[model samples]
Target: MGGSSDVSRRRFLQNAALSGAAAVSGVGIARRADAEGAGGGAGQAVDPRSTEASGRVMNPIVPDFAGEYGGKVPEFQVPKRPMGKTGLQVSILGMGGFHLGSAAGQKEVTEMVAKALDHGINFFDNAWEYHKGMSEEFVGTALKGKRDQAIVMTKVCTHGRKKDVAMQQLEESLKRLQTDHLDVWQVHEVIYYNDPDKIYAPDGVLEALTAAKQQGKVRFVGFTGHKNPLIHLDMLNRGFAFDTVQMPINAFDPSYRSFEREVLPVAVQKGMAVFSMKSMSGSGEPIVHGALTPTEALSYAMTVPGVSTTISGMDSMEVLDQNLMILANFKPLGEADMNALREHGKQFCDGRYELFKSSLKYDGDLGRQQHQFPTAEEVPA
Candidate 1:
């Protein structure tokens, strides 16, 4: 098990003290059973992708939380939507696993998991390379006993055409997540031009994924790429059945490479559930740069037609609360409003905004020490 550094340990103790006070003040946290159905009964390990399985009732948001938005606030439960033709019904707002591990400590992450389940958000996203596996480790710890309350998805970063290398990564991910099987396992960051050919090659990662599926280690398969919609389409074009497809869904997507325009329809045609990420322009910098308010950016992603869930990395309680607030009051933008937002987005859609596409910063590098992919003998025939 990965141990926290000295600084992290101190932070954990401090945060734990604060949490105890918060609990005493009546913050309205439901216990495991009432809030999340932790073990048996409502929380019994049903399909992680389905919300109806929990059978929890959504209470309406009290008027005090309405804030500046006047009039009746919508009911408060996180909404669930169908994921393509897959029998999974995912929560519209998913917890980004990368950020979960970035929390101050294990206690904080555990609290976030509990709170997210309490708020009805069930989809969680992670990747093997995130924080060098620390992220998955923390997620595993946080979800120690409440595994059934959330749909956990993680990715293997190797771009290898080798099944053994990919399978090794999958096994490592499973161990770190402390789960026997994953709800979803994805091909992470398919940004390079030849990624699709490599993935579809003989003895490729796809073969490994099929083998894992046959072994019941994974329930669903999908891929995520933000650099280009063409790459996303290429993966789809290869004719493999994908249960989910994740990409950037935001105010500016329609103006740039436009995953919404070039790829979303194709995924829909293939009956793949759409997962949205980078709504706040990946780093939340665009909001600071005045592109759009945080609420507007998030709402923009949530309203895109056919999106099953939009994931934002939440490392703090304040951010989680703010996002939940946005979801609680969300109303899809009308066509005219969407058009206007797109026009506003046009000014900022230049490649500079989406660095993951224009640069290699976000690419998953397994490092030189690891087995380099496409080894001479492993190359596609």
Candidate 2:
């Protein structure tokens, strides 16, 4: 009996050694744990694991923005912006997932995703049609086993007032994302005159979205528009509650076609999360006109009140790292930083709204006729 007991103890010790080695090698074991939701629920605090089973190693860097202003960095250095009136707190800098699917390969996509998560970016944005749904796939893979670590937001762009079609699209998105629910589900790519009436018609997209929320498949509902603030406002006022609104909020935007002046305040007043996009002067044109450096452009956007988050397309690891650094070190822009950026960017706004002018690059839905609103002539003038 004593000899048999000694042999069993030796066997158990050997098995334990092998298990520890496998965990250190980053084998499939840790991934399984994460997928099982072993750590915690979404947005729960994370404890960095230092074993090979941790899958990918992430470098966490909090930028020293407060240092530039002669102030001590707060213990919670990353600013949390509220998502509309919902009282959901999100990182001030959000990761734009559109380019992640469109413009990146698997390796680049995975690296970017890991880096963003490491850098405290909780808000992630994606669209169903982006990269033919490759974006969602990449995100799903990168976030595998780590779904509870961040807030995932995605959009759908199906046509018509067909509830079934909308529901199908939503399911497709969920499958692609490998998630049971989304933090925010947005009506993607809204443009001129399509009004809430058409979108929220009898069997409309809103019905599907509301149903999803009720089912715990989505937490919040919102909309995004790159054109016509009036359309955005109309959609908001159309009766259904929206938790968030995304629009073009940039320095050049204020000079012409000012969503900042007209629409942003409305969103803030309505207590909806205000997401800002087109901060790079829409289509990356501002860089050519010497308007602002990429860092300066992001900084300017960060300073805006009611601007919950600024989403930027990060296709490359370098771009991802650069953005992470900027956001990590993000200090609220003072008068000097703000004034200099505005002055430097003034000359670029010479009646050339490239995004609106060149319909080919920006307006992919123009040919569909689904987005068209009634012209003044058709409206019985």
How many collisions per candidate? 1, 8
Cα deviation of 351, candidate 1, in Å: 2.1
Query: For every model shown, what is its TM-score relative to the native structure?
Result: 0.77, 0.74
What is the C-alpha lDDT profile of model 1 across 164-197, one tens digit per residue?
9889999999999999999999988777678888
**Clash pairs, model 1 backbone:** 37-43
lDDT of candidates 1 onward, in order: 0.67, 0.60
As a TM-score, model 1 comes out at 0.77
> Over the stretch 87-167, how does candidate 2's per-residue lDDT look in tens digits?
678888877776565434888777767766666677778877665678788888788888888789988775454778778
